[model samples]
Target: MSIKGSLRSRSLTSTPSSILKRPKTLVHRLSEIRNKPTEVKFELTKQLKCIFDGYVQKTESKEYEKLVIMIRDAKLTDADISSILKEINECISILDQKFRLFVEAILSIEWTSRGSEVIEEYQVFIVNLLSAHTYHAKMVIDKLVKLFFPGPDDSDWEDGVPADEDCAKCINVHALFNSLLSEVPMCQAIFVSSLYSHFPYYNKSTHIHEYYLHNLLWILEYRPNLRPEILNLIFSKLIIMDVNAPREEIEKYLNADEEMFLMDEETKSIKSSTTAFTQVNRHALAHTLDVCLDKIFNYFVSECHDSQTKEIIWEKAKNLYLEMLPIFDRLILPTYDIHHVQFIMFMMTCFKTTITEGFLNYLWKKVCNLNVAPVLRQAAVNYIASLVARSNFVPLAMIKGTLQQLAEWIHSYISSQDGFEYVNSDIRSHSVFYAVCQALFYIVAFRYKDFVQSKKNIVFLQSLNMAKMVTSRLNPLRVCQHAVVQNFAAVTRKYQLAYCYSVIEHNSRNTLPVIYLDEKGTTVTSDNTLNTFFPFDPFILERSAKKIEPFYKEYQEADESAETVMEETSEVDDFLLNEFPNSSKNKTQKFSYGSSPGFKFK
Candidate 1:
């Protein structure tokens, strides 16, 4: 038989009528009622009310599936969707407070899980819902923000994994948000408010923080106008989490051997410690901060490096630095005792030399501005020292220039106090002076190899008058950290630049009073010691360290003769025994070091 004859001869009676007939969909019924008389439309409205009420009461009804099909069908044209939305809005009274279950069902649909065409339809529906129904804007926006994180069951899965379905959901959620923001400009404020209100709590799990932060940064790709507000909000929350975490405990846990103990169990035991349960709580917070910061650092790396040309990368990095500077000042600068949070600024500086210079100059101005708060000025100088010492991107000229300016400032301060012979060497009265002095010692100790690389460098170091600063009546060596002072002495003696051993020896023989006085000369603290905080100390975060380590400079041990090593080893043993009296012999020796002097946490 011919091909046409063969098809006609097939059994046509076997086809089912349900398969042949077009089903009556919600959108088709709603469109048909748009032009009908009031009575006819009211009848349809009454039917919609019944369907909504029945769906809420018995979720198994086929009416709920019809409603979802109406919202998510790709074959429906925009005009058809608009007509359906108009009828839904007209009958929204039926979906009142009691029918919230139906509303939630609509909002809970996995729009991202559908095909692309269906996703587009769902986006259109949500944008229109937000714009037309102001009362539902909060509900809709809250749902959108909640979608920024993974569902509770999927929380253990790694976020942003390319193979994971949840990753696509994240991308689509932000895409939907961008569409909503663009289509309904009036909802922008509401959307931002929802973001702030929905941010993961400080005590939330680490994965929760990572997922939310990753999604928040994804929003920045399209919403450049809200960059400042969004970044400020993120960093502000980060500072809160950062301050609550104790850096010392975090380091101890990170450096501990995993084979010796389980981290989760240790954290729980720490929480149960009656003497320091608060510290244990902070331990968990610290892990969350670490994960959150890693996400932010990854965002920054992608923003700066995704460009094609170096000039474009530089421009992007410069702009990013400018945006973050105010946040650093407002949130990170004045905050005390935070460990790794400010490294965000350090990572930014690594992008270009010009940016590094700009950051250094800004910090130097703060340090030299006598009118600024003393505490902030001290913190600014600390940041400068840490950045100069730890960043490989900083040039030799910039380092020398910073050292010169610091020396000039210290000399000027000493000259100003010339007439006050009765003024004692009180740390509280001259906190900034002591802070700068320690900064100078730290930088020189860290980068002394660079200074001794050439004769010109040596001359530059000699011109700083290190001996005068060390021997001044202010007695900076007496107040600076012991490890820093010892390191400075060793380097200056090795290079024949300046002698600090005599001053250190004199300081060791006598114990200065522990009393501290405030600006009003009232006693403030009895335990007087300068904080040995290096803000850029080795970035230990496992995930983000990949972005940081290439630009970071680890401490280099100076060359030592056999005799010198033997002598330093004996000294370190004695120091360990004295410092950790209760520690076992092996434990004390574990941290003992010889000749390589840098910041050593106690």
Candidate 2:
């Protein structure tokens, strides 16, 4: 018979069952493609495309097994492998829009069984196949990211959930990608570029867009050079979203008599009251904002070793931070978690000389703005005080200025010897005092020399007396007294006075005044300290107590005289005078100056 007639006869007899019974026969056919006649080569390409076309429907068929084995075991020339990939791509275009079946087949193939040299040889074909199918490439990347760096919402966040078959498949595929990324230099760029291409589609589907963002961050964690490009893309999109609000929504908000505007934290812009985004966008935006903040802050604080690089990053971050000020006002939205303070602290680590003065001024403006919520004002003040206490770079004037502002606020809100606002008020009075005292304690305990040398210590103590003056107005149920006493103890300890001892002894006479360290290792007084701070002078208590019958009255009278100050600050009575109240018996035991253990540096 002629060759055409013989080929027709062989095609008729080569059924899938017959081909699978002798699976190695298909490898032999593929191997001949290099030296085959033109007609035979074209015929082999058509046959390969047909096999690829059946990847989805006949995945369990014998023909499918034969095709997989041939691809794995065949020793074809580069040209022949390229032709096979071309045929597969053609099949991919015509058969599946998602390309899920083809991707699964390609990724699921046991490349290890083919040997390392074979995988190395076929690298071009594998990458080409994936790159030509963008959807498939993304699917592979998403699977890899999900398996490796799951976000907080991912089901795998909890430890007990069992991973099913799909998860197992993803693990195997991720391992393959990891090998490819390391072995093939171009593969990483291709993967990164594919993700960058999908930027425009972010707002189209929030979950998908968030997945893309999460994957971008995850990939950059291992491969950090791509951060600049990724950040530029994210920030640019945010700007566009801000500028692209619907015209009617813009007019409705901006043209209204009052002009109601809602701040979009992620976009760093104000939107109209009516322009509410979908829950998906909101959730995605919130997560994205958190991730972006962390990335930028980390880059600014730790990642950049070169001064020039850090400066560039700091400039970019500074702009973004100033733009997002409205979002950081967490008091405006009680549920919000703003990291502005922390962000500013990190910036101080880099641009201390340039940024500290400017940032402190900004914080003061925030704290002093009456239009802003008081809770947020106190928070900003707390940040300033913390920076002052911890950072030597902070100017003395700035530190003293922050303390003055805090003291002023304490006197106005917390120390008003009048009725404070009820618990249901927008800003609780005790909270303001708590914030001030906490900030003051940091400076007093950590930076005592500066406090005394600058004469701010006296001002700080005077401000603390407001905490005392308001205690009578505080409801017995209120607990600010405990916090106030602890803060007072810290500050007065610098002067070597037994403040905790005096206050504890005065409040509950029958209850022994003792100091004990709690689990967190802070010195604490008894439950009476929780009631109020009754004014007392421990220096007088040190004097012969038997001779002073009217000492309480004299001390209270002497406190009114500003000129009166402790003559001798003694450390002999710095600790409690007796043993600690046994923890096994009295849970409310307190610490006195003479009885307590001394400071522990470690």
Candidate 3:
């Protein structure tokens, strides 16, 4: 008879003892499991499998909770937890429905009493299990990424109509998975691989595509090793996602007008529709491209060290640069001005190792290309200037010629403001002037001292001198006489003031006497040599030096007297201090006083 059948039979028995007696039930058997350690382990495994089977069939059972209580009540050891994990791993390929339940049960082992080491011991297994079951892991991760990076879609937003219980369950699952991933660093590789593979399928209308890119970027923050491949993928997408919108269609939507315009017979509906989709993709791709560029540049600066890695990164970047060169302006024109600067900065920053004379000349061509937007041209100038200031990649000899070219360009912009008619207004010219000035400041701040020490490099020093002279003649407010360009003037003025302030800061803080360019082209460090344009007051520094000199001399005399008294009182001779290893007063004080800033005695 079955257990239930036996129970029914026992209740109907005539004898009082038989009436009271009952056959062992499942629950009774479960209670008996607690009586012995070996029996408990066997019962635990059987109960887990039964719970899993019931879950697979969609049958109701309170056994999951009962198992939790059993594990808690039995105080399972690490050996038991490992056994449970092994069983779960074995059952994973058996039933798809049981996968999540098995994962939950394995993770539920009372890590507190079994000791935290139990989790560490099984973390690798958990990571492998998740990786082997890639589809389920990706589904959970995708849901979480969508929640975190909800794009233009309004439906997934939290402020939308209330989410049902399933959404909450997904969120809780994501948290658990995230916590698990954080603890197991090795699992990140699997997660990143899975996320990266989803890129080709990201063209859907839903914000799933946007979420996909955002997650890739999110992963990059923690895993910088993936920079090169991620950058290559992003750059490849750049060419693929180019927007070829008709010039007329783009202009029509620039200013949003509520009034409906009559459709022109000349307009092609097919082209307009294509343009709209292309525009959206281009905008999205631009953001992704920027993130890729930013991450790649940051990695090169901070974490990139292996020479082999550097060569690989350089080749990938060089290929992208060549590929993107043709479509650069077509895609970027008429976008946000900051994006223009970012594009230029990325181009400049990503090539640290492969910068050549050809590349420098190419950037020079861009800066001097009057046909280009004044803003972009100025950005090019800033990039070159930063290269000149911070990097030794550019040949020092070539920098001289580059500076000469830039000085002439700035003079041309200032003289023929009307030729800047290609731009919107004189504001463009003023901005160009301001950028040149800032560039000059960096050049002077960088190379001026080098010139001072190594005066024999006359070619570079002369080029720098010419740049300084050009800037000195160009008045800050000369480009914008009209009130319309006052904001631009203010901006130019800010850069000028910044340059002046930086010069003064260096002058004041420098310990050596400041150097000045005299009209006779003589560099001097003398206080009596006056240049009204010079920012620092030499007389004040001299006076301060004089005031402190006597006091310092008195202190020196007192120190000398003390030294003499010590010499007379001590039995040890000065020769002992020089010759012996452990002599008293082996060390002596050296005092300095009366030195001016930017001065050093030969």
lDDT of 3 by residue, 1-602 (tens): 89999988877775687657886889879888766465344246464577767755777356665665565445577777777666666655653534554454454554422344555555545555655665456544453334434324334323122245334433443444455576655556555565455564323432344434444544555545665556545544433432322223322332233222222335333222334334233223333333334343443343323465544455545554554444344443223222112233233333553544555566678766778787666656655654554443455666666666766776565566545445432233256665665455445444443343464654444543333433343443222211112222222222232122222223234334445666899985643211111111011111122321222211111122212121444333221222111223333222222111111111
How well does candidate 3 score on lDDT at residue 399?
A: 63
Local lDDT at 402 for model 1:
92
Q: What is candidate 3's CA lDDT for residue 146?
A: 40
What RMSD, rounded to one decimal, does every model reach? 13.9, 20.4, 24.5
The models' CA-based lDDT, in order, is 0.73, 0.44, 0.43
**How many angstroms is residue 43 displaced in model 1 relative to the true structure, after the best TM-score fit?**
14
Clashes by residue pair, model 3 = 511-598, 512-597, 512-598, 512-599, 513-597, 513-598, 513-599
Write down the RMSD of candidate 1 (Cα, Å).
13.9
Query: How high is each candidate's TM-score?
Result: 0.75, 0.43, 0.38
The per-residue C-alpha lDDT of model 1 at residue 547 equals 69
Clashing pairs in 1: none
**TM-score, prediction 2:** 0.43
Cα lDDT tens digits for candidate 2, 499-559: 4444444443444454667689999765422221111111111112222222211101011
Model 2 misplaced regions, further than 4 Å: 1-47, 52-65, 68-83, 89-92, 95-99, 109-138, 144-299, 302-314, 317-350, 353-385, 414-429, 454-505, 508-602
**What C-alpha root-mean-square deviation, in Å, does candidate 2 show against the real structure?**
20.4
